[model samples]
Target: MLVISYDLEVFTPPCSPGALTFSAIARLQGNIAPALPYLNAVLPNAVYNPGAPALVWKDGRRHVVFHADHLAVSNLEDRNAAVEQVERLVRLVNETWQERGQIEPSYAVRQRPTPMMLYKLLPGTNCRECGQATCWNFALKLGAGQVTVADCRPLADPIYADRRAQLLASVIEDQFV
Candidate 1:
């Protein structure tokens, strides 16, 4: 069983043509070029494929990347293993951060904007617990950054594992991860 893994939240922004995310920000500006190789190695299963540039912000740095997608994966199953992998990957990128003379390298510290959250609420059961009437409507709200992930109720349902998974993919973490 795939007991645990990083839970990812994927979403698109309203003003942009592609998606906006937080993870991409950690790659940093000058560090982005060198960091890609490390990210590519760790995220072997997850591909940036057609993901467009995203806006990533931390403390005082705002990374404006034009093409990339934000990915959210499970951090539950085998957290020790997952955290270890992330740590190794971070070390690789931190090397790049050091070359730039940055005092600190921030990783996973900002909230990413994902629009896909609205529909993630959909049990596909069309259960109209939310006034929106449809999950798609909720998704639209989420993409606009108007609706929050907590507003999604069906996510708490045990039967909505898949739905919860989808919801997980559309939220941005609020921490200096």
Candidate 2:
């Protein structure tokens, strides 16, 4: 296992002081740099930086980042949640490492689609079917990985098939589509 132990540091998010959400960083004992490319290949919508040798992803409102020998996560309910999240991430890394043989390593950098770009492809009608007030709001969440393309129900309508195709091809995560 690439990650067997770590020291945890939990704190309130600096962006929102005293906010209920917290963030945590785990100082790992082993470096998982060698497994990053494999992770980049297998993890849908993961942003991998060859220069930083790191991989980052957003699972709903939570942001997760993996470095050579460390892992950081944000948007936790509390320190206890942070601990569980970090341990879960460690298990993910270890599992990915073990499954490396079945995956192709990806060194190519793929840029995340911008909110404006995503908005252009969205149905202009403020249908609120997705529960968001506007299509633009949906675009913002989609760009940030907080929501998936499937959540925008209008996109599935046959009338918007072309735009939907474009979105699935460009902005949507590989796993979701």
Candidate 3:
């Protein structure tokens, strides 16, 4: 296992000390550089920085950064949740390491879809069917991984088929971070 154990430190958000939610950093025992590319290949929306030897991805609303010697996660519910997330990441690293040979490492940089870019493709009907007030709001959530393209029901209309396909290609296909 690339990561057998780690020292976990949980703390309130530095920018908002009074915030109820917390963040955690797991100081890994060993480096997991070898798994970075493998992870980059498998994890959608993962941004791999070969120069930094780090990979950053998202789990729901939580942001996870896998460094050579450590893993940091933010927007956690509690300490236990943080530990669970850390363990999950450790497993991912080990699994990726074991399957590295079969995986083609990706060093190419990928840019996430900007909200404006996403908004441009949306139907712009201000349809509240997506639980959002407007297409722009939906785009914001989509960029944040908080909502899915499927949530925008208007996109399913045949009239928007072309735009929908474009959105799928640029965002949905890479929105699993």
Candidate 4:
């Protein structure tokens, strides 16, 4: 076991009986995936999007939400123990989240129309190589933090090297920071 420990504070949408959220949180830890057996079994159409654990700052509330595929720990205590469990779970969740998150951009230059810029920088080959008809469309989704730059096979060239780097850096910053 690690010398230091942590706690996470998680806020989920709404639960149905024993249903947990896709993502979870503990105070010391931010993003940990939740275990949802009831929902997974009951709602087959439920989105099993294993979202990245992130430290979200919104409405003056900093929450760490993780997109979970399943929950493993069944020893979460009510109050104090919950705190310790949250912290430990948070650490583990962060490790897992970091392992599966968006690609990082090369530069830290913030831009509002990033998706558009990415689209413009895209090759626009639409050769179905990137699994999309238009690179612009893909860029739009990428900018909205929906898709990754690697999706564009054409852009995966030496010509778009610099731009690709920048785009990846931006993505990583958003998801990890």
Q: Residue pairs in steric clash, candidate 3?
A: none
Model 4 worst lDDT window (10 residues): 54-63
Count of clashing residue pairs in every prediction: 29, 0, 0, 23
* Winner by TM-score: 2
Error of 3 at 71 (Å): 0.5
Candidate 3, residues 104-126, lDDT tens digits: the string is: 98887666679999999998889
The digit string of per-residue lDDT tens for model 1 on 26-98 reads: 2222323334333333332222222232222111122112112222222223434434434443444455444
Model 3 regions lying over 4 Å from their true place: 111-177
Tens-place lDDT digits, model 4, residues 86-130: 455445544433443342212111234566677767776677665
Q: By the lDDT metric, which is better: model 1 or model 2?
A: 2
TM-score of 3: 0.62
In order of appearance, the predictions have TM-scores of 0.40, 0.63, 0.62, 0.36
lDDT of each: 0.38, 0.78, 0.77, 0.42
Best by lDDT, which number?
2
- Model 2: per-residue Cα lDDT over 33-85, one tens digit each: 99889888887777777776677776555767778878888668998999899
Give per-residue lDDT, candidate 4, residue 97: 38
Task: Give the candidates in order of lDDT, highest first.
Answer: 2, 3, 4, 1
Superposition error at 165 for model 1 (Å): 2.2
Q: How many residue pairs in model 3 have overlapping backbones?
A: 0
Ranking by TM-score: 2, 3, 1, 4
Residue pair clashes in candidate 2 = none
